[model samples]
Target chain A: MPQSMQPGDAKAAEIKAVSIGKTFGAFHALKNLSLDIGRGEFLTLLGPSGSGKTTFLMILAGFTAPTTGRLMMDGKDITDVPAEDRSYGMVFQGYALFPHLTVEQNIAFPLKVRGHSSADVKRKVAEIVERVGLTGHEKKLPAKLSGGQQQRVALARALVFEPSVLLLDEPFSALDKNLREMMQQEVKRLHQETGTTFVFVTHDQSEALALSSRVAIFNHGELLQVGKPQDVYERPSNRFVAEFLGEINLLPLDTVELNGETAAGKFEDRTIVLNKSITLAGKKAVAAVRPEHMFISASPQTSDCNAITCRVEGATYFGASTKYHLRTRSGTSLAVSMPTASTSPIAPQSDVWVSWPVHQGFLLPDGG
Target chain B: MIGKSITSRKILLLAPLLLFLGLAYVVPFLGVVRWSFTMPEVGLGQYRALMTDPLVQSVFIRTLRICLIVTAAVLVTAYAIAYVWVRGSSVQRMLAEFCILVPFWISVLTRAFGWLAMLSNRGLINTWLQSAGIISEPLALARNELGVIIGMTHFLIPFAVFPIASAMRSIDERVLLAARGMGASRTRIFWTVFVPLTYGGLIGAGLIVFVFALGFFVTPAILGGGRSVMVAELVYLRIFQSPDWGLGAAISVVLVLFIGALLALMRRFIKPAHLIG
Candidate 1:
């Protein structure tokens, strides 16, 4: 799964962005955006649709300019640099391969455009073809190649020059699930071999977790949270972050109070205490518990920090894990995922108890 | 739009233009064709004599040369305009397109009259050139093929600009950006990406402009003033001045065949539907 992947530690080209903002007349496409992408790090800006992810990447690519602030690379200000002069490799969404050129010609394009001699172009393109695992398909036109192969050609063309950074904007969003997964690994391996900083944009959380050294979750034109995938998944800063990373169970303050949970206990059903001291005041204080954290049993247990007795609304048998839907007395529902159910497996419509540790949950600010 | 059945909906949704063309244009064209063949009670005589005439052949050759030059000039200028507009800021692009449209709205008659005012012996340009001591005797600017070509090219710029520009615009700008990000320079990007991507539009526009130029009459008549006679003016002379309707209609039919064959050959190369988006 390439989970052990680590970017080369040595200092490489550093891209430092500072408070970049862009507005398209009436719409604020990007606002107050700033992120310092470490040299050789593969960072992904993860988000749902319309989260300003692509706008941030385009600012880095130099195609769209920030209305305010500046961008620097290795301490050299490059805010106003043209895209062509930025010397970056990019895999555009949908892989905008030149249809008129054959595979060899497409790969040779960058070299020829840089004014390399014809022989040099031929040799360099041939070497890149093999690098991208497209050695035998040089003569084929882009249309003749499958979507995956065309994608590889795009990556190869972008990589042939070995630009300072590689920018990808949903490069595999067009491929099927299997091909997409395969290309994800291929891209990770290529990053390892070349040791280039890759800033990828995508909405797929699993893909982000699979590839990035760190993932930055974005929402409503702001960076919601950024950390190692595991860290971010296990610990999100707010409700949006918690919900965006994965499926989350939101416990209202009352639910915590009824269970006598000290962490995030209720105060007027709006505020809660995560500890003995703090009285968090808000219209709605909510705690997010991951679906995997909750366990289902045949009966309620008093010792459990957080437990609720609800009817087993439904059950799903996945080969390895069994998921159960439990509805509380207040009609609130929760999903509990576990490797195996009890010896007396809870059936649908049967009363059951759900339990999880208090420390596993977090209080998120109300979305409003 | 060019085929029989005039309304061949199976061919294209816009096929009704062929019907409109047949009614308004083909009827008059056939009438001319019949008139050119059966004048003076009929024979192969008027066309045969007309073909042998040295003046008629020279004028035909001269018109072909004029059309080629004007087409070339318009294509180059239109490409430059479209390229600049495509890459410029939105405001500049809108302004450039608006500027191109301005010359189109001004009538050809008014523009030719404006050219007459500008290129006459005592006209504004010649007056300035004379005052600047750059030329003498008005430089024979008017009453020649030079005046005719200038006016014709001026009127034909929009036809040359539209199809090519639309084609160029449809070419995903991302392809050029991808090439550049891969280390392509401006000139390389132009020749390899932009040129090839928009080739169909350019050729289509060029063919249209060249074909339209072959049959132009008003600008050439007003500008050339009998010193430079294009084939259209020669046909007019044969029809009305000499009462040689047979020669005139034959010339008209020949011109139609020339332009029609060009349109057909162009359709073969420039089918926008088969072109990859």
Candidate 2:
């Protein structure tokens, strides 16, 4: 094993799940979910807690057996294989470094277990330790290192053996925002450099979007959608995916109709058009618009845009953006986020117009 | 000084226990040391006899050997029980605790007698073996080194298990899972990760069991069948039966010094924090 195994050197594994289901006694954790992870792909499983993303990740790692399913690796049945036999590197949520071992020993554990010679283990340990920026701290125990340093040790230990797949369960959840972003970039760089198949699980949507080549959104034991981050974020299949990814404004509409590839719906007293068409048999539907897409102004600004008049009830000032919370005359609530640099701050309780271009809003089945 | 002022107040609170220890343990121990040295000629007569006495040397060696055996056996058995206590389900944990507590709460003499009954020739074990046609005659199971070891190990097991179990409970469950994910086999994970993590508990338990075993008197006397003459039995013989108080005091002094040396050696390897935390 080398210190930093190249992506081309790794045997990146392609994994497929066939209708996997898991049950803990009477409670079902995951239901009939099938997903195929391509070789050398950074696929992230994104979901809220208890949405079975971690369970699915555990099943993929072969730590948890599915009650009913078949897992295949490169078309070979591996459902019965144990985690040790699978040789998948996992950076657990807490890092899980051996408290008794120094950083170098912890990184060299896998190599030593595989019966490598002392010289080979030493060389690989030195290389990976330096690669992880842990050169002078190789002799320091896990308890002596800071959280980010310990995290790097875990990452180095996992990558040193050049496993077929790398599984991470919210590895950055414990880190602060700045360190998390830095680690995420480090993870992405490592993935690109090694070209190893990476399966990451996280509830943080931004993290999922920033790191993954493909993101799998899960909810209520079901795989809601799996696609590129842009595809999933821009065109969420349902209201859950739409709202879960980020803050979205959903407005109930009536008499929904699909004309060619555009959706038209009646909202309040005006007819609105959606850029993307959705097939909903019922007349009741909802128009889902992202908070950033909606622009708030002291008065109506555009003639052909979809607009609603409302009172600004609240304004939250982020560093780069300000979000205005508004309530319509009919008591419907809406939110609009605008760049702080471009827009003057709107006072709370001010009457404003929340509008978006016709193509920015999409329609979804109502009450789902 | 602030430190002196605080210590003065603290001394008032600690006065009762300090008085009790000084009167109850320290004074008596000092008396024994004085008697051992100043009994006959106020010289090294008892010490010289101890060096030249073959009987005393044999008993001291036998005591050391038996204590070592009991410590090893108790450590192994306790570790197995503690592992189960940590990883097993509720019922298994309850059962393991029950087994350890039963021997722990019972009187030491009663437990030794119980072992004596079970291990005595023609007792439960030998009778069963004979009935099963495994042996033509009853085996010498009791009143020997093996019998003494078994009885003492049973007595020391609960003491050994608690510290190890505490250490085991402190280990993060995810560490083992991480090891398995990193391609370590089950046995490898146990030895490499799990065992090393429990070293503090092992050292604490080992110190407790070995020190207590060194001074053991009851179980060995009952189960040893007069064949295993340990230091405690020799002390008893010298003090009570033979009426040689000076010699007994000298042997007691040696035992105390040996235990102190063992503790000092172990203290270098085991941090006091590990024992408490």
Best prediction by lDDT: 2
Which segments of model 2 are wrong by more than 4 Å?
A1-9, B1-23, B41-45, B48-52, B88-95, B120-139, B264-277
Candidate 2: pairs in clash: A7-A194, A7-A195, B143-B224, B143-B225
lDDT of 1 by residue, B1-277 (tens): 4457666556675557767888999888889877877887577776787789898789889999999999999998888887767778898899878868898789889999889888767778899998999976677677799989888888898787777777887888788778777766778788878898888887888888899899988899989988889989988888789867788888888888888899889878977443222
Query: Native contacts recovered by candidate 1, as a share?
Result: 0.80
Query: Which numbered prediction scores highest in DockQ against the true structure?
Result: 2
Task: Put down candidate 2 lDDT per residue, A183-231, tens digits, no spaces.
Answer: 9999998899889999999999999999999999999899999999998
Considering summed lDDT, which 10 consecutive residues are worst modelled in model 1 chain B? B268-277
For candidate 2 chain B, which ten residues in a row score worst on lDDT? B1-10
Q: What's model 2's lDDT at B26?
A: 87
